[model samples]
Target: MTAAHCTFFGESNPETVQSMQGCMRKLKLMVPKLRVQKRVKELEFIQHVIEYIRDLELILSEDESYTPHSTQISPISPHLDSTYRP
Candidate 1:
């Protein structure tokens, strides 16, 4: 059997480039055999991991004692409250 070869056009060593090309060829040939359901599950797991990382980042960035100015309003006057009464 004739040996297969691939050419690389960069500063890479010939042996390393040849091995990488061979592995890429094998991966291309095998990709069509991968299941769609398995791919979806893998993507879902990746998405969940990304979301968990974002949530943790938000939690870590927040101050435990931080309070919003909106929640610090003074009590409304009783006369102002009666104006909107049904």
Candidate 2:
């Protein structure tokens, strides 16, 4: 009895097997770093939102006539650029 293996790259080739194994190892290492970077971005976005809210609160408290169209730019202004009028 014999076992058969098939791949686009020849299955019996040691070089192909080692190259694939190296690629897999590199991908495994990158996955966690990618996750950490994604999480860091999320935290940064949350921080920006918090700061924007704080600025809004300060403006509202300082001026009874505060409006969304006021001159002050937000920390998250890029997101508001499309919807904000002023």
Candidate 3:
């Protein structure tokens, strides 16, 4: 069956069944890469949380080894704004 939805450059150029199958195949191949990227982001977030907890533990223990850098800023935090000063 022809793909009625597949078109190019505002043209109604009908895609053959082969072309549609190829598109699906390409999308399937890309799925792994997308999944890997998502997993990496998840791992990074977990690691960040672990490190934060470790820092908090050190501070609570009064080890003086967990000094938070004043210049450090969280790029992932949405709570920060242009007018907001710490």
Per-residue error at 8 for model 2, in Å?
43
User: How would you encode candidate 2's per-residue C-alpha lDDT over 1-86 as one tens digit per residue?
Assistant: 11122232546477767666565444333233332332345455445445545654665577677676789764633433233221
lDDT of 1 by residue, 1-86 (tens): 12344434464886867676575454333332221224335455445445544544454357475445447655433433223211
Against the true structure, candidate 1 reaches a TM-score of: 0.28
- In model 1, the clashing pairs are none
**CA deviation > 4 Å runs, candidate 2:** 1-40, 66-86
Using Cα atoms with residue i matched to residue i, what is each candidate's TM-score against the true structure?
0.28, 0.30, 0.27
Give the range of the ten consecutive residues with the poorest summed lDDT in model 1. Answer: 28-37
Candidate number achieving the greatest lDDT relative to the actual structure: 2
Model 1 stretches astray by more than 4 angstroms: 1-40, 64-86
Sorting all predicted structures by TM-score, with the top scorer first, yields 2, 1, 3
Query: How many angstroms is residue 51 displaced in model 3 relative to the true structure, after the best TM-score fit?
Result: 0.1
User: How close to the true structure is residue 75 of candidate 2, measured as C-alpha lDDT?
Assistant: 60
1 or 3: which has the higher TM-score?
A: 1
Clashes of each: 0, 0, 0
